[model samples]
Target: MSRLYGDPIEVWTREGEPIQFVWRDRLYAVRRIIDHWVVAREWWKVDDDDPGERRFWRVEASPGQRLGTYELRFDTTGAGWLLVRAWEC
Candidate 1:
């Protein structure tokens, strides 16, 4: 897996499920969502109580000709969307 820290992206969702995303100047259509979960705020690591949760989605996608699995995250604290990791399948 390759890590991408804070890589900005645009996602298209249908009924709260991510259908596709644009990242690194390419469009990737999600074929399947492998997992979905929420990361709760780490209260002990922060000074304040406003550490918002993060949503994560692991998906299998096709970017043009190649297929890959990627981990996407959304920060509720205004950090925006991020492409966390990706690997060829």
Candidate 2:
């Protein structure tokens, strides 16, 4: 398999939502949704009483209008997003 770019996204229950988006400096008509995933996690120990809060959903995000399929992350944390997984079909 070939290597990809960008970061990991925090998926949720939103349809056709933008995990990442872009508008090229050139032409248009290059929109595509090729990313998908389900994320169910809780921020307990890190958030306090507001802990045990579980989240779930499916997301198909991407990066830029040119390199469309390039994945990226909107990581809630400040360390920046890391590519955890992806789909190629």
Q: Which candidate is the best by lDDT?
A: 1
Best by TM-score: 1
lDDT of 2 by residue, 4-58 (tens): 4444333332353444333233221224445445443354445543333222222
Question: What residue pairs clash in candidate 2, if any at all?
Answer: 7-72, 8-73, 35-60
Lowest summed lDDT window (length 10), candidate 1: 42-51
Q: What is the RMSD of candidate 2?
A: 7.0
TM-score to true structure, per model: 0.82, 0.31
lDDT of each: 0.86, 0.37
Q: How many backbone clashes does candidate 2 have?
A: 3
Candidate 1 residue-wise lDDT at 24: 81
Model 2 residue 22 CA deviation (Å) reads 6.2
lDDT string for model 1 (10-40, tens) is 9988997789999988999999999999997
Candidate 1 error regions (>4 Å): 44-51
